[model samples]
Target chain A: MSLETLSENRSFGGTQGVYRHKSQATGTDMTFGLFMPELAEHARVPVLWYLSGLTCTHENAMTKAAAQQLCADAGIAIVFPDTSPRGDDVADDEAYDLGKGAGFYVNATQDPWKPHFQMWHYIVHELPELLGDNFAVDRDRMGITGHSMGGHGALTIAMTHPERYKSVSAFAPIANPTESDWGRKQLGAYLGSDESAWRAHDSTVLMTEKGYPGEILIDQGSSDQFLDLLKPESLAHAMMARRQSGQFRMQPGYDHSYFFVQTFMNDHVMWHTERLI
Target chain B: MSLETLSENRSFGGTQGVYRHKSQATGTDMTFGLFMPELAEHARVPVLWYLSGLTCTHENAMTKAAAQQLCADAGIAIVFPDTSPRGDDVADDEAYDLGKGAGFYVNATQDPWKPHFQMWHYIVHELPELLGDNFAVDRDRMGITGHSMGGHGALTIAMTHPERYKSVSAFAPIANPTESDWGRKQLGAYLGSDESAWRAHDSTVLMTEKGYPGEILIDQGSSDQFLDLLKPESLAHAMMARRQSGQFRMQPGYDHSYFFVQTFMNDHVMWHTERLI
Candidate 1:
């Protein structure tokens, strides 16, 4: 539960703190952005976990994403973690979609990656314990959302452990990772060639096999460059086949980018607010 | 007016086009960001000029501001200009503040800078003319805003040419450059050590002498690290001395960073929206 302050700055009567903690799960140092809202006399607040996509650091979402105002208004603290462990010591690949940038939110049992690529364990198990122990976060009212590869992280994490997260949403998520090239490559490299092992990480397959206890919301752009890889319809079809009711929206003419995310970001915040309240 | 498209990307059913045009004032290539809203049959829209601070390129404010959604809602096109012209051929000082970044939005009559540091003419005359001829911006419905040094730019530019801009605003702006070290060094180097010459570039002095015809709005952070250099009260005192009606708000516990800007950015956008509409 020990946390070391990496950096801190003041904004809108709140403190934006960047902290680093040694993780036992991944055996690597992890960084996260925590914004403690200006609260009324000694009142603890709800928390929201935001995951980012490939080739991103903890600072990207914290600095660029205009989500703090909503979080402040809703009395929620936001936690932003680095996409994956990054250092000269950790194993990496040249491709942008695999190795360091592409943790895919799973505990790898494979060689080279087995030591420090346990993002699933770090995010789901260790992160919550550290946040609850160190910060004033109401763990009972937690929610999660992310973009692209991180969207896949949010979905898989929430579906696997619904009790831990009260609400869930995503933007331009890779709905079926096993069927997409980016997903297949990463999964084959990290989880081996066994197709059965891939299903546990695919949201569409997971939804079809084990229906989520609560409603899931997803927002995708019609003009996304990776629209073929996202496969939102497959997720919808799977939900419908299982008689599962959830909200899946397809926005017209938007793309897979921060601009698209910023357009619909406030809506996701409000959505989580309604459920968390 | 020849326009060269430097880059273009699809976001939110519209396109973000970055263009480089040969400026008649500086005789150097200048860049600006244009957000063309989802065009519903080609309607002319109001234009907003966003000037950046020290050591920033045109791309910084364009990509990081998150001002597109509000602009789209207000049906306004935003233009972000680089803080200063830059090239190996162009004049540069060893420090980050003096030669290139410290354009001060004035026509330099001093050595080295005189040949190319004509941002004043580039912004006030050349930019509007080129934009009016090529883009669908209403020439009469233009507004201006900026941050820190750029804030000084907006105020001075608007005050200098009152007929051109309809409204003006700023975030964490330098009110009086004549009194601060950064400003004194820059103005002295760019315009020589004459106090009267520096008055034309100082917003506080201009406010006391010429006075803006329209209402001026400014937002300052209480916890700003550069509060000594900013001197918001100088502008406030000048406004008071002239009985000029303007809005100057100071928020508590905010620093002199983009995080502070992002917090109250919606207010500035809405303020311009009210004026534009």
Candidate 2:
């Protein structure tokens, strides 16, 4: 796939670039934001892929979380992929929890949604191949992270492909789709109401089966309004029951907003950098 | 001078709050952002005021620049004031330059604008008093900084009121508003056609006459789109010519966006903190 460089700006001794490309996975034009540290120009660098939450583009975490300075210091490249297939030709939904912004990182198996809602392939396959070919990304040393819905994507995807991604982290992630109301409803629409098929895409279920080989990092806010829906405790319980050596920090007085993410971004970046390098 | 708390979020062990109040100076409601360090809960701490650029609100620098953790580490509180008066009743122009977002930080002396465009008084007098009374602010160790038009606000205000502000800094500030086209035109509208009236508000002219009492720090991106309009070299030259010691860094490959501002924000906050503390 040919990539189009939309914009690039120097940030914290790195290049923060916005790129667009034709995606065969989603069958639409997709855009992603990237922050390549100075190390990438000189030699290959480990990359941390950040998936955004609902109703967010590549700009939200790229700008709000401000991972460049830490990533730059650690000589790591950070990539931000879109939440779902976009553009007018793509499928639409009236509810904020079901449609364009809510990909749930799954390939749709139903009509009106099957053609474009293939974010699972887009993120897990197409984008990674594109990045590995174009950028100085060490495929062996890649890590995955996200916020909320994207956090669901990160955990499930990393759990499924532990051999590909070396590390995994999340901020206020949806621990289980099958247990979540909106998540269950959306997954049913995309996967044809097959509850058994949803098990492979659920973090709590997957973690209970075979825990991730490496330690996982999770930061959930104590004051998040969406705390009930997220159900991070269920995943933490599953993780602990499986004897998973993960770090689950419940930050007090924090919320679901980027402010909460920014407060602990340095810790996450450094954690990934430590394992990545 | 009663302030209504619009919103407050916990950030970096501090409180990031958005407040609104009926301004006696502007004759309309004004909003501002404040980040009070946790140390302020027990004792008064030094405060830094950040003025935003044109086409920006108090939220822009607060969210994008992200100066909280560093300020928190240094135990300094920070405040953000609005650029201009707002509401349906206030006078506005079709253009982005001379209207609501472009207050130019001046007490307008011209028609239509004279009634509500009293930003100079609001920022220099009303805000300081309100902050001092409400927050745990050390009035004697206050500092000021801003970007673009707001940078002009910081430079001119700090120079004129040296006794009130101890340290000053800017990021690509308009040096001599009287010489620049938009600066000259906007100043003419806000302060009548008399060019002599603008010298007091121009950083170059102010620095040339009596230089700031303390060291000033300016970080201008070498690749800034508004390089010509900002005229940072003129301000640097004037400061140097007056034997005014300051730190003027030309950051290469950076632009005028918040990306650039965010990159150097930690440095500016630290610089202000060193002087403030």
Candidate 3:
């Protein structure tokens, strides 16, 4: 669980750091970013986990999200993990959506992809333990949020482990991945074309089986080019049938870009802070 | 000048756009980023020019500085220019400090760099006029700021054309560039070894000769790795001797990174907003 500091800087009256560690889940060196507000300088604070989309590293959100000042003001810590296990030895595909940068945040069950594509385990189990041990983050009060593929990760992970995460939110999440083209291709490659097995990692399927007791928040851009791939409307219908409550805000004239996420980032931080603190 | 929209996205309840245009001053196509807050949707807003440091493109400040949210809140439009004229035809040196990304905001008199390294004319005259013609920016209400080399550009440009810029500020500026290695090399190469001509583009020299009537604002990181190269102390002395009133607050335990800039970006935005509005 020992972490190596890649870089650290004072940002937004707090510490913004990047660290690398050997991961038991992925069996590779993993990098992650952490932002601890000034309040953490005195005492432990609630943490909000942020997972980036496909082809994004920890630096994507760290550099572009523009959420640090809001997080600092809210006195919350944020942890951003690399989207996938990365190394020369790690198995990868030439496609941007399937390999290297795209871990899909699932424990792969297929060969050539099963060993190191264990972001699900790395993020859900190992990373938290490391953070709780090494950083001033309150383990009891944790929330999760992310964008696109990472949004799917946040939703599915939160629902599966209801006791671990107190609140959950997402931006432009692929709400019903099992039915979408992207999901079918990725799940087929990683989980071996077993639709039954994918139910365990699909937010809509999992929620329909056993509804989440608490409310969720999601923001989607109406003008997003990938709106069809991210079937939010279908998810909303499924959640309605399951009796789960949440807010799905569809912003107009926005795209699936960091700009769209940054526009409403402060609101998301505040929503989590109110619940976490 | 005609400009083409390279890309545009919604951010912080506004528009973030990148544009490319053929520049008469530099004789090359140049790109710049613009952030127009929601206020611009209703009426013209004050414009702020942000010049980036050495070895940077327009994207550096746009992606990393984390200032757009604050600028949107303050109802200011920010224009970020490329540090240098960049094209395959543009002359360049092998070194990072002397070539493409390091324009030093000067009009080169030397052979190879002379044709396309006309950043002095680009920033002081052509860019502003182009912005005024194409955007919803109030031409009379404009302020300028930058980091390091760009910071030097802000100070020198604003002082030289005080009537054009309503306010000026900088982050980790190379204040006494005439006395630093970076300045000597850049000025020697660009202006052809004429020490006397360098004074025209030196902030310390300009301010000493004719003090700025309005107050200036500067933020310096005490722990900056290039603190010796960016001699704020020398600028402070020159200002005091010339009876110029400005605040040079040396922040403790900060560095020469976007992290430090983002920490104090809100304050700088507010400073410019107050004077411009």
DockQ (Cα-based) for each candidate: 0.01, 0.01, 0.01
Model 1: colliding residue pairs = none
lDDT (C-alpha) at residue A276 in model 1: 78
Candidate order, TM-score descending: 2, 3, 1
lDDT of each: 0.81, 0.87, 0.87
Give all TM-scores, in the order shown.
0.50, 0.51, 0.51
Give the range of the ten consecutive residues with the poorest summed lDDT in model 1 chain A.
A239-248
Steric clash pairs (candidate 3): none
Put down candidate 3 lDDT per residue, A200-230, tens digits, no spaces. 7787787778856566777777678897788
Candidate 1, B1-277: lDDT as tens digits: 6899989887566668899988778768888888766651277778888888888878777777788877777778888887887777779899988777667788889989988899998889888888888878888888999999999999999998888888898987888899998699899988998778899999989987998877777777767788778887677556533544455555656788888777777788787777876
DockQ of 1: 0.01
Instruction: Point out the worst 10-residue segment of candidate 3 chain B by lDDT.
Output: B239-248
